[model samples]
Target: MNAAKPTASLFQRPAWVALFAFTAAFAWGWAYPLIKLGFAEFGIGRDMTGSKMLFAGIRFCLSGLIILTIARLTGRSFSLKEDGRKSVVGSCLFLLLFALLNTTLHYAAFYIGLSYSLGSRASILNSLSVFALVLLACAFYKSDKLIFRKVLGCVTGFLGIMALNLGGEESGAFTLMGDGLIIANALCGAFAGLMTRGVNKRVDVFVGTGYSLSVGGALLVIPGLMMGGTLHNVTPWGIVILALLIGISTIGFTLYNKLLTCNPMGKVAIWNSLIPVVGAVTSCMCLGETFYSKYALAAVLAATGIYIINKGKK
Candidate 1:
């Protein structure tokens, strides 16, 4: 008989779960504006696709190394024998595939898509990943079945996302490189959530996350460099922004992945609706961008959706 899968005792606590989830959301929300700032500070233009990829690759790769180093110090084994199903090479290959889908392809689409899309539209479309996770979890996880409350909560949260775009100057214009890719990035996030849960069951959550980010990030750097990507005219502020982004990935992904292992997917995912709301409000505050009255409404809607999802829990 197989032994039970181990879980992080601390993450199972309600307070810690709430804290980490909110922190992750806030960090991700802040990343929108920060990324824009990084580009400006480093003199990377909208058309510098390779540079964008390289920037993201460096951030994630460093974050992964940080996680791995911490995990090693904490005595987590880097071995794949725990699964007993795949050979060492096979396990590496498995993780490589996960890294590809979860990090490389996902963020590649995201950085490129952001170049072609408006920030407001990107915020709304990217938050759609929350809904995707809720639905996908139902399909894959036996515990996360579909229900009226789940549907209602999702609709409400999604309305919050849509609310942010109301009265905005964004046109209905769409492109495969812009809108389509952002939507695809959202879907990648949804799928990655599911994959995180599975990986956690077999390996240490931090280890899996570390591998995914580092390996996937390296893949981006190779092609990015080949395409002549460069972080030119980088200033001190740019370096600081890059470091903060690395910290964001390290903290946000580590805690979020840990939360996934211990909580219901729908309940955990519902909070993601707040990301765009936070992104919109933060963009205004940090980027000297326009603030819309609809932002307040969006926050309330997102909060309400999270309450409903958690309140109706069995």
Candidate 2:
């Protein structure tokens, strides 16, 4: 009578998990275009880091609030209880730290990076998290050791990723916001990924997610407003796009992190390597950018690399 075991077993099915992963990844991929579009719709200038962070703050804060509400109203354990009453205090403390690292730093870097770079280029560069995670995991966890197969997979994936930038256009955008900040975003994600493991062990995920996002959003919003940030000319379409952004953050994070809970990190993250490819393709179509023949080839390489990495898993 292992009730939880069956749920775990169901999630363990590779096909089911992969399907879920793809759906969430697809939702996330749309963010590149939506954000670029949102910037236009909301009158957010390219150099307006304050406005950019304000928008991000709103997106994450609302998403977190909605997610936490859903989980709580549905009778899920949305607060820290397993570790007793005293643990709630500690849980709140952990959430503050997590919010600072995960949402505040990660999105501050991401928004600033996006402001300076094209969505397509940012998409490609932001996914360096996969490679960063491989290194960090190998260094921190004995269980996630590196082998020839893993190395080969990483190389193949990275090569394909780099190939996306082979076109002169992609290469030309390399700058602080283009590559450096995106890499920083990736590193922040990797750092948060490690912290998530500890958070899951000690706190209710819904509560942590809610607290961190709310706190982080407030933090960003304060500074942004002080810096003369204001969202202007919001039309109906702007509301729709902002709502979509919130949906993506809430649903995408829930599904992706749930997958990481039920499956191995490599299994979850390898599939995520496709985010950049998906983002690039989506951006070209929606952002009025031209697509090149080499982009298709790069997508194939990235997909193949994901398969190779997953296949190498024991």
Candidate 3:
């Protein structure tokens, strides 16, 4: 990433960069519809309970291997050692903890939550990570202070979250399957982000991410299989789609991270608003659901909050 920093600056060409950023962001957004389509194709449903986890496990595991392969082909280091001279034990330990926090627990809850929730709702609610991380960082890191704008931003974001849940008993009420699971998923993801910050100083960033995803995802498959999840309904076309989803994860994450490493964090961070926006819109289209004005309002509030947080001075 450091060596490629110069080239990435070329990507910072305002118009072209915006296009690249949106395209990358759209790939992540694509996951919303693709995951649902996977569920439908495999005959998985909310009632299946374990199938979603199983499906996510496969996607992450495959994506992880793909990433690792790319890293190796590009001659990137996977060493856990900060300076490439650490013991095998230390490296193994780093991979273990990273996999646990970043992939295993995080996606288990996320996929399950997404299973029971509307894609549009899931996209909006999952944006809670920004606010949640603000609070988490304040508690854990000396440098991350909460000021007036941040607090106000967090409030605005939370209000947007509340707005999404106001329709009625069917859509509004929190269930273990809906709001409950997504909130848990967001917390886990925030922690994972923090964990990444910590471990990046100790190991190769790409290596840690790749290995953790592979290990954690493989572990998820165990519980899913024990819980009776199966991919018996998958077809050749479904396999092709699943492959596409994995490609999204692999390419989307790498590019997003690379851009962040190469440019101003604020510049890259603002593009994230596109993730939920694209996810909600595409999910609505895929589900054949009508667009509601509330979704727009929610997206704006949440996006504004994220902007404020990232734009804060150090």
What are the Cα lDDT values of the candidates? 0.80, 0.76, 0.75
Scored by Cα lDDT, where does model 2 land?
A: 0.76
| Candidate 1 C-alpha lDDT tens digits along 1-314 | 99988766787777777788888988888888888888888888888988999998999999999999999999997766467255666666767777988899999998888777656556666877887788889888888778877778778877876675567354435578887898899988889988876676557778999999998899889888999999998788999999999999999999888898888877677667668777777777787766556656766786776677667465
Rank candidates, TM-score, best first: 2, 1, 3
lDDT ranking from best candidate downward: 1, 2, 3
Q: How close is candidate 1 to the true structure, as a TM-score?
A: 0.89
- Kindly list the per-residue Cα lDDT of model 2 for residues 45-128, writing each as its tens digit: 988888988998999989888878887897877556565356777766776777887788988888888777767767766667
Q: Which TM-score value belongs to model 3?
A: 0.85
Q: Can you write out model 3's per-residue Cα lDDT over 197-246, one digit (the tens) per residue? A: 54556666776668877888898888889899988697987898799998
Please give each candidate's TM-score. 0.89, 0.89, 0.85
> In model 3, where is the ten-residue run with the lowest total lDDT?
257-266
- Once superposed on the true structure, which residue ranges of model 3 sit more than 4 Å away at CA? 1-24, 83-91, 170-172, 257-270, 310-314
Q: What is the TM-score (0 to 1) of candidate 2? A: 0.89
